[model samples]
Target: MRTILYLMILGLGMSCSNTSKKNDGIEMDSEIKDTVTTESLSTSRMEADLKKKGYQTFSYKAGDTTYLMQQYYMVFLKSGPERSQDSTEAAELQKQHLAHLTRLYEEGYTSLTGPMGDDGDLRGIVVFNTATQKEADSLANLDPMVKAGRLVVEVHPWWVAKGGKLK
Candidate 1:
């Protein structure tokens, strides 16, 4: 069951991207510029920047278009062995967990996160934009729920096209 869930999440994670939503009939630009740089970067420059930050990336030409693929960490939050916390403690931990994830998103470390719909051992998923698996793992472990042993993380390296979006 765990393996199947992991595979399903992995597939979804690979398809997920930081995409722009359409407003009415207008199409919004999907490319997200770096706030620190405050300017749009060329393909080569972007590649260089990602490399400088220890990110794994590659580019390939698909007919007339070029696609840039980047490595990201997908963390599966599963039910931990220690689930004996009281209701109040569990609630507090849940709040803290959300706050932690929000901070990570604001800090540009997490790309996406949310709870699973089914009541399974797989509780949630967090896609991290960190360069290394170790960094992602460390950040995930910092979550209050994980620290409290209510949740544990299983991380995998996933790849996606830069600025790709769900259709």
Candidate 2:
């Protein structure tokens, strides 16, 4: 979907890091480590921070690589049964919905959000970086569109690599 693609592009843009120098024919791990350390917290420190914030997280091993998997809540916004609002009211609700999403992003509660390309029952998605599904659901339900019955939300737990980025 276009929404998914848009979120992927946004994520890739945000994840760009400083380029590191190569040593001879190989890239030095230390250089990579240093870059990561400078841009954000170290893995152990990040894990500790997440724990302190009550976020669910775990370390995953795949062959020689280890990844930090963090739990997030994905809220699927669907078309609601109540669609009889006038154009003016609907437009106002849409504006309020966008403002709500912006607030969540600014508050560090959402990582990604966008509408789908099609006009099906599934309207959009919001990836909430909350500690619990209840919190995510509560926040999503606060959206003006949802409150006005223009949209409804179904939330589910999703796990993602802490710093994984799309290429």
Top of the candidates by lDDT: 2
User: What are the lDDT figures for the candidates, one per model?
Assistant: 0.87, 0.88
**TM-score per candidate, in order?**
0.75, 0.75
In terms of lDDT, the poorest run of 10 residues in model 1 is 31-40
Residue pairs in collision within model 2: none
- Encode model 1's per-residue lDDT on 12-51: one tens digit a residue: 7854544445766433233333432233236658878999
